[model samples]
Target: MPSRVLAVYDGSGIDGDLYTRVNRWAQSAPHWLDELIKVWSAFGLGLFAVFMVLAWWRARGADSAVMARVLASPVVVVVAYGVNSVFKGAVEEIRPCAQIHGSVALETCPGTGDWSFPSNHSVIAFAAAASLWFVDRRLGWVAGLFAALMAASRVWVGVHYPHDVAAGALVGLLVAVVLTPLAGRCGPLVDRMRAGALRPLLGAGELPLVGHGHSAYRAQQY
Candidate 1:
């Protein structure tokens, strides 16, 4: 992944300099700023899950297409995270802070073997962002902005290099772009499951009406 990203950037001597500048900023930043970055990174890790569930909850019973995308959110997140983990395992690239000297990371370096080729936080964030976007453009844009912030926070905390987060974001976006359409393709399956035993659990109940024919319109549209 790093090699591919480097290729994409044509070895433009920027990755290293970017890392150095970001790390330097992290080192010299005010204490409160460091604390905020740390908090943001930690919050970023959980924020996607919150957004995904909220999206699913809000889409209950309206627009089958939207619900389908919402339902697919978990699958997108899991698959993207799994792919990121596989890359981490295969590459086993040491964390930037561990490799660079005089790197004052805001957060403690993870224990050895915590490979850092691509940023998991970025992967999950972008995956959720894409999923949310598929369901609703407005919400998707908001989530996408948050995803960008989360990616930056990973770099700000000195846990991920720019390339790492960039690759991760790309991986996540690709996964969503490829798989979100499954929501539309799997319309029959989602419809079948609507009245199944897990209906209550999945919140397969009627949602607040939108425009005319809300639920009826969704059924026919999807």
Candidate 2:
């Protein structure tokens, strides 16, 4: 049976040409480089997970506000993915590998009904990167670079058009920008958790001692 065409937008014009060019380049690239990109395109998201765990571990020693933002990174990625899914379903854009004739993908082409307007991998990666920005600037910069590479890899692997990854990156960034600040406001909740049985997860170090009675007051404030 033929796959249904439900796309409201088609990128088989300029985007298709660009994809073809990239695919040609990939075909001539070193075997090791292609293999590396294919592997990274598939599993690079795991690095973002590691980054998040590191951020969480480091935030444990920081104030509750910082910790709250770190904790919200995963949530931001989830929300961004959900939003990107809605776009994929609505746009219904077919994968470049399927839409472009005579195109060879480094990775296996996704099957029918798997709409591919905005790349999910791109969305998750950029969302994590943006969310991490609210937690730690240096770490966020590293994640941001990885996120860009991840987006490009999707196209290099011949699964997505340039526009798809670009739109996905935009969606992930917008969602994170809007949600991360609100997430940071959950500091009071983090404080409550620290006071309860979750202290081991939230607290990384002993509270600093202030002058006499002030130490207890400061501890309660955090």
Candidate 3:
């Protein structure tokens, strides 16, 4: 394992204080609620996966542009994770659970060299939420709310500092914002794929024709 970048500045100011406060609350909170957050912090990401599938299923009858974005949602999440990893490696910030003294994390502290400046869970959740926004507004809102909860849960479980989740959320949102439009541009490609052997995966329904030119094929708000 590579040497952890020693903590030149461990963000022990307000961030560490907030983490300590939350961790302290967790210690005093009801056992069931603490366990619930612990479980959610670890596994709530699965719900986002289900949301993506739901978005794809709903977009099947929409225009190719919409389908393209729905397909790209997972890709956006993967890319966001990759981007967040780069930040993690660059900062090499130690996990708060490991750095803060007298702190008790519900989740086990990650081993050394597993830097934690940006929470990977937060990145994946928010990226999925932002990508879904381009496909359907209602689904987007739901996913976005869940994303926030996921970010908070990381701190509640005492694995990440507040700044880590905030930065991760921003990275995820920005990545999706940049990539979703480019993915939307893939409508023509989706259109082509839908007509071929990929039809079963893309959708069986014929593409909806709306107006003149490409505007007819453009994705619309749902």
Report the C-alpha lDDT of model 2 over 1-222, residue by residue, as the tens digit. 434444545677747898999999999999999999999999999999999999999998888888999999998999999998888877788788988898889988998778788899999999999999988999999999999999999999999999989999999999999999999899889988998999899884335555676444445434
* lDDT tens digits by residue: candidate 1, 1-222: 244322221212337568879999888889899898899998766777788878878876554567778888889989999989877876677777777777767888876688776889999999889988888788889899999999999988988789889989999999998898776576556667776876654546444445675444332322
TM-score of the candidate numbered 1?
Answer: 0.81
Q: After superposition, how far is residue 157 of candidate 3 from its true place, in Å?
A: 0.6
Q: Please, what is the TM-score per model? A: 0.81, 0.89, 0.88
| lDDT minimum window of 10 residues, candidate 3 | 1-10
Model 2 residue 35 lDDT score: 99
> lDDT tens digits, residues 78-104, model 3?
999999998888777888888899998
User: What stretches of model 3 exceed 4 Å from their correct place?
Assistant: 1-9, 204-222
Best by lDDT: 2
As for TM-score, the candidate ahead, 1 or 2, is 2
User: lDDT score of model 2?
Assistant: 0.89
Provide the global lDDT of candidate 1 against the true structure: 0.78
Score each candidate by Cα lDDT. Answer: 0.78, 0.89, 0.87
Candidate 2's TM-score reads 0.89
Q: How high is the lDDT of residue 73 in model 1?
A: 86
Ranking by TM-score: 2, 3, 1
